[model samples]
Target: MYRIIGIIVTLLFIMSILLAALALLVSRISLNRHVWLAGFFAGILDFFYMPLKYFFYKFSDPRILDKWMVSLKNISNRNSFKKADRRMIIAPHCMRHMECPASSKRTGIQCVSCGKCIFSRLREDASKYGYDLYIVTGSSFVKHVIKEKSYDAALLIACDYELNKVMMGLKGKRLITYGVPMLNDGCFNTEVEYEKVIETLELFSN
Candidate 1:
């Protein structure tokens, strides 16, 4: 029995390594017209996500791999995300300024547009696009918000680790999620690529 378990574990290990390698190769080489191939590779990578995260976290940014998977998902599910009946933007509170004046509420941070942080601009853009914006402190808070609200699609911004965790949690939900990695990841003063965020929002809104 022990030997059988050992062989299974060995095969799983080998398969994960191969899948990780293929994911990286396809991402860097631009599979282009073969969008199906990219989607298939991404699905397998997500299935073996934990092992991949452990391996990548040791030597490189796991968020890069996560972002590649998200790109593949976006390519395959473009219409589904774009035409969703409801849309929302969920950002991290850490992106706020050190002296932010926003107050935390049951829904999330209520940004008064005090011009104290990035949330001011992000909130404005979200409103312009008719999206519900929520700046959350952590994954648990995000879960609570999702449970109480109903949105078919969500654009999430966070550090790589938090993004990965939230993506895993969102697996069984009926919502589609697109993640934007932060420019700098930490407990305070985090930032994201505003252009990328805007581009994603435009894609979904239009």
Candidate 2:
């Protein structure tokens, strides 16, 4: 019995190592081209994410892991996101203008399109594309948004860390998410490429 247990443990350890290696490879390669087993590799990375993040945190840039994971997930979710009839855009409050006059509620920020921030343009585009826009303060507000209405897909905009964080949080909620990472990270005045946002909306628009 002891010998059998030892053999099983050895095999499990080896399998874990191989899966982690494959996941890393897929992440790196997906940056340039489409990957075949994107969903599988993404699952592997998600399973090992905490440990891998700690490893990167100690010796390397953890943001790279988040960026790669976001890419892989986007590839995995593309088809389904495109097919989703009900979609929403979840944006971060940090991207709003400093003197912006948006109000905070349980659902999220209500953008009045006052022309002081990118959100004005985003709200217009979101309406044009038939996507509900939620300008959230943080990740925790996602649950409230989820409860507020029914959505089959979500287009997320944030830094890589927050994008990956929200993606993982929404993993089992029966929602498909595609992340567009922002140009920079900060508490306020962060920015994203407007063209990229519009491109994503147009690509997946029904």
Candidate 3:
């Protein structure tokens, strides 16, 4: 499956980044050795990474992304000439309603729902773009939300492993998904990048 392949690729990428970073951290002749070693390994990936991804994607669940995209197109057409202004963003981190999904939550943990997480920002972006987006807080409840009414697209901010599982069950849904891998499996360890989501949404929406 593509998930298996993706994990391997991601690991390789991570490895390269670590190697290059360590090399940069060293100094002098030792630094030169580090740089040469890191560059050699990183080069192997740098040269073939994109092409490998292309192949992997080609071999992935062929119809899943297609279907999700189609659904979005349908929603867009439904509101043709009309501005789409709704949202279905997911914020897995609801410190108020529930404890942080994962990790350690101390006395300082708080969730004012000020649209701080990727969940809130994505929702805002969805409304701005005139499409409904779902913020799936829990993977256990994913089936329920996914089967709900016609959503234009989905923005999944979950662990890399969970994303792979989610994709495993999904058939060609014509979706343009942005899988955000959290630092840890749950809210406690979860960290989000609002700017990245914004950038991705801009690319996906367009």
Candidate 4:
């Protein structure tokens, strides 16, 4: 039985690798059908993603991976997000100003729109687009916020690593999700392409 289990695991690992390969090679890969399969074996792919990220960074363009992820997510967006009753946008605390005065709560950070950082603009746009924006400290809060609220779709902004992990968590839940990778990754003062964020928000807007 142990041997049989091992073989099954190995086959699943190879399948996930193949899926990742298709995402990288084919721009129009239909990811919604495979998301559940990928989620089932996400642990295997998650294990390999770190080294693969570095490999792409060193040998090829990292944008290839980012674009593929975005493309796959867009498929989900088109199918479910467009019809969502409630939408949320989860931003990261790392994007705040150095002396941000945002207060923490059970759900997440409450951005007061202090006009000290990019979040000020994001908060305004989020309000205009009718998205509930939450600034979170970590990935776990994302899960918490989603569970506590009735959101049908979410837009997340984070580093590639966190974005992938969050998407994995959302797999099989039937909730639509989109991610915007931060321009820089760190514990503080991270940045993202605000224009891209605006564009994505507009896509979901009527």
Best by TM-score: 2
Clashing residue pairs in candidate 2 are none
- Residue 176 displacement in candidate 3 (angstroms): 5.1
User: Which candidate number has the best lDDT?
Assistant: 2
- The residue-by-residue lDDT of candidate 2 on 167-187, one tens digit each, is 999999999999999999999
Candidate 1 similarity to native, TM-score: 0.82
| TM-score sort, best first | 2, 1, 4, 3
Q: Among all windows of ten consecutive residues in candidate 4, which has the lowest summed lDDT?
A: 36-45
**Residue runs of model 1 more than 4 Å from their true location after superposition:** 1-17, 28-34
User: In candidate 4, what are the lDDT values of residues 61-139, reduced to their tens digit?
Assistant: 7655555555555554565677787988988899999898989987888888899999889989998998988889998
Ranking by lDDT: 2, 1, 4, 3
lDDT of 3 at 167: 39
TM-score of each: 0.82, 0.97, 0.43, 0.73
Q: For candidate 3, what is the TM-score? A: 0.43
Higher-ranked by lDDT: 1 or 4: 1
RMSD of 2: 0.9
Q: 92-136, model 1: which lDDT tens digit per residue? A: 899988988878977688888999788889888998998889988
Report how far residue 110 has shifted in candidate 1, in Å.
Answer: 1.7
Per-candidate Cα lDDT values, in order, are 0.78, 0.95, 0.45, 0.76
